[model samples]
Target chain A: MAIPKDKMLEMLHSLLLSRRFEEALTELCQVEGKIPGMMILCTGQEAVGAGVCAALRPGDVIITNHRSHAHLLAKGADPKVLMAEIYGKRTGCNKGKSGTLHLALPEIGAPCTSTVVGAGPPMAVGRAFAQQYRGEPAVTVCFVGDGATGEGSFHEALNLASLWNLPVIFVCENNCYAGAQRLEEHTRIENIADRAAAYCMPGVVVDGNDAPAIYTTALDARARAAAGQGPTLIECKTYRWRGHGESDPQHYQPKEEIAAWRARCPVARMREAVLALGLISTDDLSAMETKVDALVREAIRFAEESPYPEPREALEDVYA
Target chain B: MPQLTVGQALNQALREEMTRDDTVFIAGEGVGVSIHDNPMLPTAGLLRDFGPRRVRDTPVSEAAIAGLAVGAAEAGLKPVVEIMFNPFFTLASDMIVNHAAKLRYLSGGKSAFPLVVRIKSGAGFSAGCQHSHNLEAWTAHCPGLKVVMPATAADAKGLLKSAIRDPNPVVFFEDMMLYFAPGPVPEDEYLLPIGQADVKRPGRDVTVVTWSRMLGVAFKAAEQLAAEGIDLEIVDLRTLAPLDKETVLASVRKTGRLVVLHEATRTGGFAGEVAAVVMEEAFESLKAPLRRVTGPDIPVPASPPLERFYIPDAEQVITAVKDIM
Candidate 1:
């Protein structure tokens, strides 16, 4: 399938916006208690979120793990509300109840995100099952990464989804790291996608930095899912450019390896991909960057201006 | 009124709710097949009636199945998930504690997880250490969750019906020993309101606060205490999370003495929570120090004789009443 010029440019804008948003959050967290809670940054893995979500329809939902800022942005979440939520402000998406770890923006079909590893897969399958029961063509995309793949829930979700042939797409962001331990140290399996094969599902590995490849693969997977062909596990072989959390010392990861992965930056790669296709110009890319930067700045300003929730409000929202 | 066992009452509730709401469904291990042989045998014939879609037979995956229930409920399905053994709740605690319980609050009240987790708990029939445990305190400690433990068959039927219709995550506890215990349950449609306590046997000497399996022990102890002219008021707390302090405090004020009994261990048990509430609210009414009759702070043993010693009995409750007196 040929990529449209406008959609390609839009994907680039969203990727850049998400990256800039997380970058600002990371910098602010370092300013001596400027930010609250631990922020997990998807520094170099923007292409995976942008590309996979690009293929989703407006009615489709995506279940995301702890590292979810990129997924939310790509799925068309309001940056102001999301930022307000990250800031724990009253007008936030969750009304200041949840910080970055648990975010829910149902308007964009990203109803909720979880902090637990391997949390999204089974829920995504269940969502897809509901859609199937209702006879809707809505697709459910589950974003799995790192320690999530090592969890028993991950395997259970995969096996159940395959058995039921639910309309769920499992996108494994194999970022070469899981907490303080490296991926090689955790699992004997060379690839997370290999487990999908055991469940009788199609498993594909793509260069996560390459936006075009991810978009094409995800688009195909989405189509297969809507057609009731069960799930497809697409492992995006990528790298997390930063530590797991904002304050992680990252002494376990070798500096040379980090520098090597950082060299294959997804944003620069996406810009090249668009340029080679003659879809967008250097000036157009620069303008998109300026627009995204301004939008992120506005979000931060909105977050700052929003008020913190009153202490008494904590007693509410538990039952309803 | 039909005299039904606790298990029969629960099964009746499931059938009634599923009939009323097409979206209500059951999913868990052995729900479809072999649940008849299981300890809490309510889901024995559910699969045959509702078929596989409604009564799903999940794999041995507690954590993921609970997650699946959360998603299903969010997507407009009333999912009743049965975690067969309470001891295995440790496997699914992350889902129940983190996702199911917190989804409503985290979603800013936009999403309601109207899911039911039927957890079987207790130590009897030599179920051994792993299969015998009561972790109601864990659920009660969590916000955004309604915890219910029914002691009578009527309450079981009524509360299960309400839990299914509730627009929040409800941890419905089924005491393993109460499955065969029979009580009068009405045939008419009934739904017991959550967060309400019932005074099983009213008296003026002392208040016995208990629920689930311990309710029986408390009743027997009340009978024994009445013979000695120490009339005991038994208050069954049907719901733990929304603790009904009003009913309990009212009873304590009338009696001027309180005794807490439960299958949970003495340390950090729900008895401590109840006792704390009493001390904080009804301290002036107390004629003596609060007494607690609870299981020992040890895992339920495998041997029948050891298990008998581990479970709190009527004698222990009597002893607690005597101590308070």
Candidate 2:
């Protein structure tokens, strides 16, 4: 499906916002000791999250793995609360109880995210099953890394989803590497999509840098799911612009390979596409950037001023 | 009141809960099917009665089974998942420890995981190390989970009913040996609070605290002591977490000697926790330092004689009680 002019511009803006947010977080972690330990940056894989979330309805749910900032942003989680969470403040999403790895927002249907690899697939299936049981049209979109496909839960979830014809979309962000290990070393399959054939599902691989292509593919998968046609395995061919997490020496990939991926950056590619089509004016694009920058600044300021959680509150939510 | 076995009581509780709450369901291996020759026995007619939607026979993935239960419970379904064997709990520990035990806490009290995980435990009939291990202490160590080990048919019926209705994750440990053990069980529906302890035999000479199959061994030991005119008080710790420390302390205070017993190993058995509670709360009342009559600190052996030597029987309990007294 052809994307509308306004939506295409919005997608470009969202992708840019995600990239800039990660860049800012990286800088904050380095200079200010804001995020104490390692912070996984979704630098080059912005389009995967933006496109997948764009297809989701208000009631639809999305489950994400450890590298989850992009998913949260795409699902409309307030950057301010997210920043506060990273700051370990009381006003954060988990009241500073969970760091970036575990974030949740039940009201918006992004109930929870896990750090464990391949954990989201089965959970997403469960959420989809719940929705189906309630006769709700809400679908569950599970965002996983290329490395997560190697876990047993991933295959089990796929088989179950196919057998039950669950309304779950498994989106594999194949960023070429799982930590320091390359995807080629992990699996012999030519494409992550090829494995989906074993489960009797449609598998499609799309250029992850193209926002419109990713968005269109996700929309098709969502549509198929809503029609009770079962799940779609979507392999997003993306790359990580930065090291796996902060403080990594990044000895696996050469500088040339990193520079090559940076050249095809999703945010820049989307911007060029929109500008070439004359879909958005230069001034409009500049204004959007300023707005996003100001929003991010406000979030950082809120996080800086937010109070840390009380020590006594630690045991309060242990059980419900 | 009707005479019912522990397994029958469990079936009765599950049936009662399912009938009362439309959201309650059962999912596990051999749940909907009659795999054991006890064909269609415990969950006998549940599949036909509730249909495939409610009585689901899951794939042979304990992790998936448990993860699915957690998800279902979080989504407002009361799920009773069967692990078939106690040793299989190792496979599901990720869900039990990470998700089921931490969901409410991680969600900041926004979600409740009302999941009851039922597993058959104990080393009888030569089921060997893998099938016979008792890991209640491992579960009890977890903060958010409520662990229940009912020794009697009545307690099984009452506790299972309570577990299904509870708004927290509960690990219900059912001893395979007690499945056929019969006792008087109430016919009408009832709920037993999770943290309460039951005193099986009242005595002042020594206190014997145990639960699950070991509780029966403790009682038999109490009887042998009674024949010799040595009074023995037996306290059944029905729930592990939110333990009935008050009852245990009171019993220890009255008897002035205490012996904690269980089928699990002595190193980190539930008995150790009971001993700690006694030492912490009623240390002055002890005639001697607390004694723990537990299975040896080894895997349950395969041979009948070796398993007999490994597990703490009534004679061992009697010996421990006498030594403490």
Candidate 3:
């Protein structure tokens, strides 16, 4: 799909904003001890989240696993709420009760994200099933990592989705590794998309760093789902810019491999492409950066000022 | 009104609810098949009647079975999941504890799970340690879950119907041993609210609280004791969580003696929790300390002789009631 010049610039701006936001969070973790330890940076994987979310309407549902900051941001969740959740403050989504691993925003239809591997797939199927049963046009998008494909729930969820013809889009952010183990070391299949054939569903592979490519693929899948063609599996080929979590030193990945991926950084490449096309002026780009920086600063201030939940509140909310 | 067994009553309740509401459905393993033509016979014709969409036979993945039920319930479906054996509940604790029980509260009261989990509990028929274990106490400890253990056919039907209609997650425990136990059941549709305790056989001497298969044992013990002029008040705790402390305390105040019974192991059993409640609420009303008659703190044995020894029978209940008196 050929991207419109204006849309291309918009994608570039969004990716850069996500990149800068994550960078700021990383620095905040160092100086203020805000994020506890080493954090997973969605540096190279920004395009997949940004592209897919951009195609979704406001009421459309999105579910994701542990590696989810980019997805939440892409779905328009306030950075303040996201940051406050990470800081475990009441101002956070889920009232800081669900931390980073399990944040929820019902207003945006991002109900909650699960930390358990492959848990979101079945939930996404459930949501899609509900939409189907209610005759609602809303679609449910589930974001999972390559590691999740190994889980039995993933297979069960896919089969159920196919059987029910649920309007669900399964986006596999294949970052090449499940923690430190590479995809080749785990599954016999070269592409996770190939597994979709067994379920008789459309499966596509895309350069996850290419925003237009991901957005076009996701758009096509969404159309197919809306037309009652059942679920689609979109395997996003990307790389994680940081270790699995904040704690990993990443001795498993070679320095050259890291360097090679860094050269194709989603944000930097998109920004250069937009600049070369003259779609956005340098002043407009700098102003956008300044605005994002100010927004992040305000969010941090709001999070820092938010109250810690009362100790007695722990016993509350265990039931309705 | 008509008489029915506990199993038949439960099946009737499920059928009625599924007929009344389009959102209600059944899911689990061996639900569509009549295992031994007794345990799953209640659900035998349900699949054929309701079709595969409403009556599903899930794979032997307990976690997925439970997780799918939770997901479906959250999406506004009233799903009743059958966990063939009670001990297998441990595999689905993530859905039971973290998902179903907490979804409403976590959603800030914006969501109601309305899921029902049906499982067979207790030691009998030589179904050893794993299959026969009673874990009501474990489930009752959780805040959001409503635990129900019906001792009679009427309660089995009424309570199961209410659980399907309830807007919260409920764990419905059925005693495998009581599947053949018969009692009076109303033919017309009815509902029994969760958290109510029923006084099966009222007396003035000592109060005996029990549930599930042990209710029968308590009743037998009361009957035997009545012959000796030792009138016993038997309170069937149909629901474990949201316990009817009012009924228990009122009975305790009048009798001034208490005996709690269960087929589960003594330590950390539901009996212990009942004892704690009695001590906390009606300490001054007690003529004697609360006595608990329960299974020994060990795995249920597979042999018939050893299984008989593993569970508390009528004699044990009589002894515990007399000791309290």
> Could you tell me which residue pairs clash in candidate 2?
B40-B44
Q: Model 1, range B1-325, lDDT digits (tens) per residue?
A: 7899999899999999998999998988888887357534778778888898788888898887888888888898899999988989998888889888888888888888899999988888797888998999989999888999999999999999999999989999999789999999989699999999999998989899999999999988888888889898999999997999999999999999998999988898999999999999989999999998999999999899999999999998888888878
Tens digit of per-residue lDDT, candidate 3, span A1-320 = 56777667667667866777788776776675566433666767999988888777756788876787778788887889878877878677766567666667766777746777887787777677667766777788999999999988788788878877888999999999898899999898889999899889988999989887888888888888877789999999999878887567889988899899989888887777778878889999888778877878888898889888777766766665
Q: Give the TM-score of candidate 3.
A: 0.90
Best-performing candidate as measured by DockQ = 1
Q: Please count the clashing residue pairs in each candidate, in the order shown.
A: 0, 1, 2
Off by over 4 Å in 1: B38-40
Better by lDDT, candidate 2 or 1: 1
Residue pairs with clashing backbones, model 1: none
- Relative to the real complex, the DockQ score for model 2 comes to 0.61
Candidate 3 ranges beyond 4 A from true positions: A3-10, A32-41, A180-190, A194-203, A275-283, B33-44, B108-110, B187-189
DockQ-based class of model 2: medium
lDDT of 2: 0.85
Worst 10 residues of 3 chain B by lDDT: B33-42
Pairs in clash, predicted candidate 3: A38-A246, A39-A246
**DockQ for each numbered candidate:** 0.74, 0.61, 0.40
- Global lDDT scores for all candidate models: 0.89, 0.85, 0.82
Q: Which whole-number lDDT from 0 to 100 does residue A302 have in model 2?
A: 96
DockQ of 3: 0.40
